[model samples]
Target chain A: MVVLLLTILQGGMAYRQQAIHGLAVTGLSDQITWGLYIGNFTFFVGVAAAAVILIIPAYLFHRREMRRVTLLGECLAVAAVVVALLFVTVDLGQPLRIWHALPFLGKLNFPTSILAWDMVVLTFYLLINILLLWYLLYKKFCHHTLQVKHYFPLIIVAIILGLSIHTVTAFMLSGNPSRPFWHTAILAPRFIASAFAAGAALMIITFQILHRFSRFRLSKGLIREVALIMAFSQFISLFLLGSEFYTALYRHTAQHSSAVLLYWGTTGSEGLTTAIYLALSASLIGVVILMVRSWREHVPLLNLASVLIFFAIWMEKGIGLVVPGFTPTPLGEIAHYSPTTIEIQVTVGIWAVGAMIFTILARITIAIEYGHLKAIK
Target chain B: MANSRSTRRGFLKGTVAIATLTTATLASSSQSDEPTAFADSIASFLQDHYQRMSKDEIGELLARSERRAKREHGVDIKCHNTSAITGVTFGYALNLSKCKGTRRCVEACVTENNCSRNSNMENIRVLSLPEGTRDLNQSDHYYGVEQKVPEAGRWYLPVQCHQCDEPACVQACPVEATWKEADGIVVIDYDWCIGCRNCAVACPYWARHFNWSKPNLPAKEINKNTHYLGNRPRMAGVMEKCTFCIQRTRKGHLPACQEACPTGARVFGNLLDPASEIRYILENKNVFRLKEEQGTQPNFWYYTDV
Candidate 1:
């Protein structure tokens, strides 16, 4: 609670500074404009998309045990979307002018602008997840059994919307022909693969926490089942990463040099390159551990692998992806970027806000599950 | 479920209250300024988008902007939001063989455009590349202090906004804040721009720049002739780029960089004019555009009279 409050206070102060001093207060410059905020936005969009994993098992596979925790995944989606939107809001130089992108009141370049598509799709997906989760939780709280027919349609819509959110975001980045690092046919698949790996890993961690703190109990075999899904998804993620490396390095054009620099730093600095290597190594180790049935069955080892997977994806998709795209800028200038103090504060604060939302929603859901709260209807 | 309902209601109320507070604070803060300044601020805040505004509204906004400039910076500025001349799409051709890497055009651009002196923001970048090499990756804008032009087979390439017919920056803008003018110049609506800098990333030429801080130009150095879509003093946190000196070019004058070139290397003329210099160069010379494979269809061209 104290940490959350402190984060909010710090975030408010940083926001005030940004509003008064302009974007110059941040580490962003003309050469390296988008930074940590955009990176976080990209990461959270994947998290939201990964919610489909829970829905698939619960709705499609008809795994009765998975039904209880499916709402948890939807709640996670809501929080992730909130954070993603907040990152965009903070990144804007004129946050107040956001109404300029409004549908009717301001100009929204719908077909032309990929960003416009991203805005609409992300908002729609958020609304869908929120409404679906609320409807399900309400029905349960009112002592009414869920009619699968009613929710089955919503679940299908959510699954499609969830996948589209990340795919659209990938399109947003890859649409920029100028940035060779992002302009690839493989980016969308890689995004989904990594998103599933990270999202499932996060669900594992959240489930463990809820089981410990509340009356919530996971089915006997659910953790290992989810871990198996996470491990396979991690394998796919790694395969995609390898393919990207092969294409970039083998083609050996000036355009592909950004990838080379990202994976193996230039002569001057190897900080980012080393960081990416560490993340890749961590992911590889985690995947190997998960493949071993003995380790996967062990709760502590499983939790450890989950944490590593989360960290690996966060670092890989966050700084490892965004910064290198701009490092050797279009003009072939190497402008290094490190997040400033103010930027870090704002980012942490946004994460805190998301966590708070998730916590509140999860607590309420648990209360309803235990018959501690009554539905007004 | 009831708890969720209450929470949703509270969230909506909180959002409205915050919006109201912010708007009220913004209005009250501007009220502390001079009455005319307050009026100008309100007019600017409520100003319609460029395409939607009536001619009279545009004229009034421009006049008010001029007044604001005088009041704030103590400069007698001419704020002209000139409409594009029909049948006069501008084109530029640069004779690369003649460019001497003097960088005089860069200095002229900064002065004429009132660019940020403190940030050293200049529209034009005169890059010194290896002779007989077209690879822009090996170029450097900051050459050593050799103090002479055309040093040891090094050729200069001055790059600026190409003002492409199919500009990527225009398409990348989420709010249509930037667009290609009818006269082949790509311009940005400074007020309407949310400063996402997506256009900056989309521009392959490295032409666009974002104002990280308010531009710092001395009062005496401020250019009096300003165009609303061109070289007006830009606010902080917005995108700006070269507009072929829209104010000058629209009024039958050469751009500052073209005029400032020591050699007659830069050519600017109406593409629609059959006898214009730009058309003559295009017809006769082995002209090419940078990154033609990108399909940007740039109006700006380059050639060498070997």
Candidate 2:
């Protein structure tokens, strides 16, 4: 409840102010037209995707220890959706005119536009996740009026659809033949793996905090299991990232200039480009530290490892997607763009808003699950 | 230069031999003097298609154009209303050997088109092709003499809108803002444009530029002698491109850029008139169009002096 005001009122209003002003309040330009907003969106989608990683282990693999942790996935997803929507809205040149892409439904560009496809799929996924969440929580609160079995198939499909949605969004920027730097075949896999890794990192921290605050005890073995899932996913995530770098380094693709600018800053300040490089390196170090046998067993060390991986993935997957894309333009000219102060303020505000949403959501889910919010029959 | 060619040709064949010597008489032949035909103007030209605007329709346009001149510029402008003659189209040929890259044509275009000093009106792209490199593909667009200008093994090429027979940009515009004239010039209607920037992507040459804000113009610097055909009032948000100086060319005068070339590398003409300098150049010079694989059929061409 104390964290509510910081997450909701202040963060919410900051985003509202940004939306009304258009992108003028942000740091986008002809050179670096995308920024922290896109980075956050990409990062949050991975966090959302972490729900599936949890779902796969609990439902398909039926890991008995992962059952009570299921609701946390939906809560994280809800937060991610809120954040992703915020970023996409603020990124538009005419934020108010986004409806032009969907004026009264199926009126203009139909099949050809990938942007339009993202709009439809993301909305559907958000709604289905909402229903899955509400139905599950209602079953707990309404004296057995509903069953989890009723929405099992729909939840299963939603998870698959969610994975594809993030992958398609990556292709939206990558598919353009003109944007050579973004034209990578490995972009989709990298996005999926990073989304899982980042999502898993978020879960570790959120679950930890939830356990400390709530009456319900998240079992010791279950906590260990979640950390193990995060660790394995982080390995694949880092491996895919390495493969992409290898291709860019080995091949003298004229398009390699984009990665080069990222690895080595251009003209004085490397800005966010240099920052991402350092952060990714730190994340790799965190991964190594967490790999030790005793780290996941102890609460203090696990917390430290989780924080490191979370920050690492946040830098590697989140900022990595956007800052590198726009440094070099389609004309092969180096166009350096940096985020402004207001842009940073607004972005921090959105993340806070996402936290506020997750907080409110987690509170509601916890009350229902523990019978605190039970209704009189 | 225009009068000398016609007069000399007339003298060589004896002026009396051709019954119609109106070619030498600008006062009797030009349409800039006509005004009344527009005062009681009506769309009397049979609502013809763009390709086949009848002479009466062309006359109606000329009349409407005179009215527009009075309305916009407070001065009269005219259209000669000359039809492109078959087997008589003009083509331009430049001896690449002569171009010294002095940038005289670039300046001439700026003065003639009345472009905003900030926008830099000229579309001349100077590229220095390296010496002993036959691959035009590898040549860089920006060039100095050392990088591959007129050095021991290098040459320069300036490329612009090709005014293609099949233009992708005109076809791609959701609104009918861009159109091609019969004489091969792609033009834009600045007022009707919505600034969607669809045409910018569709263009193979990136010739089109979007006016993201209200144009920075000095009202006094606005060219008062405007034409409905080209260089008129441009709106805040729309696409704009070179119109091959339709105002000058319609009156049968050379483009300002062609007249500005100190090296005489640039050439201008009707592709229809084989008897003109353009046709002579096309037949003699080894001319090439940029990105010919795209099949744009552009009006502009480049070639080596040799």
Candidate 3:
């Protein structure tokens, strides 16, 4: 609770200047316009979408004890969605004009603007998640009287809708012809796989933390299940990345150099390239090491593997995702930009907000599940 | 599952039917923006996608549009005024064949467009392309920092907006903020635009320029005789591009570039009319649109070895 409060304070304090003045507080120029907000928005959406990979195994695939930890994912999802929204608002040149996006108030540019669709889909998905979490918690509150089986179909539908929100976002980036690098058909699938990779890692690490605290109890099986998923997801993300590289290189088309530059730095700059290379190497090594059951049995090594996957995917998605789309620009001037101190602070601020959301929701869900602070029956 | 497929088929059929109806309606009276104004006179009128309004429904709306144009452009010059097909658009043909490395059209576009009149803000660039090459591969757009003119065998292609028939930039704008007029002119509504720059990205011609800073026009340098369709105050953050001087062309005046073209390499005219100088160029010279396979179908055609 205190950690959540501290995070909220940090996020609020950092964002206060921008809210008071305007986007002038940010270092985004006409070139290198999209900064960490877009980066984080892309990253968090992937994390949010990855929740379902675990959700499906537990609820649909009927993994025992998946029930106890699935609520943790729902909590993570709430944070993810909140952070996603907060990041977009921060990203807007005129955050106040955001009210204009609402159809009742302002014109909704449909189909042409993926942002309008993002607004619509995210609003629906958030509502579905909130309702689902409440229904499950409320049932637990009332002495677990309500039949959980009746809600499974509805839960499945909600999961599909939630999945669509992030996939549509990937499509929004990929569909535009202007962004040649973003114009990949494989973006949605790649994003989903990456999301699963990150989410599994995040869940395992968080569960380990909770288990260490001795406040809450979760099955060791669930931890291993998620770690295993993290292993596969890391492999898949790297594979798709390789496929993208192969197509870019062998075709020897005009688009090849930018992708190579994106992965391994153009000329003298080692930017997202370093992250992509380091992350790929570290995660690959971790995945290979973790694939063995005996090594996976070691909690320290498991956590080590999960942390590496988590950070690697973050670096890959955050900087690696945004910069490639911009390089070999429409004019083909590799417009270089380094995030300033303010930009880094603002990114940290967004993380703080996400952390705050996760913390509060975790408290509430934990209380509900273990009957700590039971809801009024 | 069978029912779902049938439903999908039904949806597709309905979509196609709607599309056909739309195209038919558009073709019937697509001559002018007046279709909405005289909708009662025309039959089979389905409402537009912007909002469903008939000719009778939008009299006040159009007045607001005109008012917005006046406020934005700082002139009451007839807004959304369609051009008549009967124009003898006097075009200038640049004989790239006879051209020296003279930067005259560069000066012409500057003066005629009433641009950043201080000579620093000229939109038209005389990109010096190298000998034996038609593409920009040999061109030096990055030729700054005291580079010598005619960099060893470089031929100059005075590159500007090609005034495409199907402009990709026009379609990318989410707010219908930028559009092409009847006179083969692509224009932008800087006020209506959110400056998301989807248009800037969508433009294959790479003709568009963004107003990074509010244009620094000195009081004396400011062209006060601004036309709504031609010269207007551009906003910072919004995208702008060459309009081929619509304000001047619509008034039956030659573009500044055409007037200044000592080589007469640049041509501007109504492509529909066979009598225009551009039409003659089309008939007599082998003119080609840049990046033909992309199918942007630009109105501006390039003539070489003039």
Candidate 4:
């Protein structure tokens, strides 16, 4: 609690400094306008989208064991969407004047702007998860049986909305023809695949923590099932990544500057080559570990592989994907971007807030399940 | 006991109301010494978006803006928000062969637009590219202290806002803060912008600049002639770009860069008029737009009269 408070206080001070001095304090310049904030926004949006992996098989496929802990996925999604929204808010130059994008009271260029579509989809997805979870918890607390007929339709919609949120975000980036690195048809599918990989890996770690702390009992078989899903999704993600690298390096057009900057150094710097190599090697190692049945049964190796997969996807999707697209900007100039001290503080604060929210929500849900918390009549 | 609690609550409410009233009174009284300052503050807060404002409101806004400029910068400025003239679609043609990499246009644009001196934001980037190649990778804009101008076979290309017929920046704005005018120039409503910088990334040409800090132009050096959609002083945390010098071009004058060019390389005139210099150059010269395959269809073109 003290740590969270101190981080929040530090973030508050940084925010105040940003508000007074403007965005000049951050590493962002005119050349590379969006930085760590937007990168985190993109990553968290994918995390939110990944909630469907648990929802789909558990609810749609009628997996009884998976249904036991599906609420955990929903809770994580809600927390992630909240964090994503906060990142975008902090990224804005005029944070107070954000009402300009509000519907009706202000001008919202809907249908025409992909960003407007993103705003709609992300909000709708957040609301769907929150309401669905609330309804389920309410029924559970009241000792009433959940009527599938009543909630199934909402779940279906939530699933579609979850997919749309990440797809729309990909469209927002890919729609910019100016940036060749982001302008690709395969980007949306790649985003979904990587999202599922990271999302499943995160849920594995989360469930482990939950099991250790609470009365929530998750079976080894269930963890292995999620691990299998993670392994498959990571394979697809790695394949798509390899395809992108192949296309960029094979053709070697004038548009290859961004890709070169990502794989190799620009002039003197080794660029993000080390980061890319780490992500690739970790993912390969994770896939190899998960592929072996004997190793997957071992809890320690499973946890280690999950951690590796999580970090691999995070590095690949966060800095590896965003920074290169802007480094050798469309006009071909190298403007290096490294997150400043203020950005790092605020990012950590946001993560701490997210963790707090998830912990509280999970605790309440667990208490209700165990009948320690009663529903008032 | 209930009666006592109700009485205490009433006393607390009364105290809060009195405190609020006293604060309001003090705030109004402080501003009462200068009526114009108070009025300006109120007007600024209540100012409508440019499209929603009536003619009379615009007139009042311009007058108030002039007053604010004089009060803030001690400069008598003219801020015009001119409507586009019918039958005059503005176009530009640059003679690339004549450009000497002097960067005179860049300096002229900074001075004319009153761009931030401290941040060094300029709308124009005069690139010195190698001969017989259009590769942007080999181009350099920061050619410092050259012993001579137009150094040995390095041709110059001055890139500004292309003012596309279908601008990507306009489509990227979530709020309709930036848009294309009828005369083919893209303009931004600085006050309405949320400063997401989505438009900056959308633009193929790096034309848009964000005010990272409060623009630090000296009061004496600040350009007095401004346009609301063109070269007006913008607030920190807003997007600004080249607007084809809307203030001057609407009044049948060339853009500042065109006028400032010593080589007579830039030609600006109405695209609709066949007799205009821009149209003549378009019909006669082999002209091309930058990033032509992207299909932004920029009104600005490049040609060589060699």
Each prediction's fraction of true contacts recovered: 0.68, 0.00, 0.10, 0.73
Top candidate on DockQ is 1
CA RMSD of all predictions = 5.2, 14.2, 9.7, 6.2
TM-score of chain B of 3: 0.67
Model 2 residue runs over 4 Å out of place are A1-26, A103-108, A145-148, A251-253, B1-306
Candidate 4 lDDT over B208-229, as tens digits, reads: 9999988887899988888888
Q: Candidate 1's fnat?
A: 0.68
Candidate 2: tens digits of C-alpha lDDT, residues A17-53: 6555544455554335557877787777667767887
Candidate 1 lDDT (Cα, whole model)? Answer: 0.86
- Determine which window of 10 residues in candidate 1 chain A has minimal summed lDDT: A263-272
Off by over 4 Å in 3: A1-33, A212-214, B1-139, B145-148, B157-167, B180-184, B207-217, B225-231, B254-262
lDDT of 3 by residue, A1-377 (tens): 57656755666776776655444456554445565778788888888877787678877888867766777788888889888887877665434435435553234566666666777878877787888888888888777776668788867876897688878878767865656677788888888888888888888888777776646786777777777787787778778977887787777555455676676576544766776788787778777767888898788888788888888778777777776676665444556666665557677777877787777777778877788777564
On lDDT, the leading prediction is: 1
Query: Per-model i-RMS in Å?
Result: 5.5, 13.1, 7.8, 7.9
- Model 3 agreement with the true structure over B228-299: per-residue lDDT tens digits: 445665544556677777766776777777777665556777666777778888898977766665567776
Report the Cα lDDT for residue A318, model 2. 65
Measured against the true structure, the TM-scores of the candidates, in listed sequence, are 0.94, 0.67, 0.78, 0.94
* Model 1 lDDT tens row, A170-234: 88888878889999998999999999999989999999889988888876588877888898899
Score residue B225 of candidate 2 by CA lDDT.
Answer: 50
lDDT of 4 at B206: 87
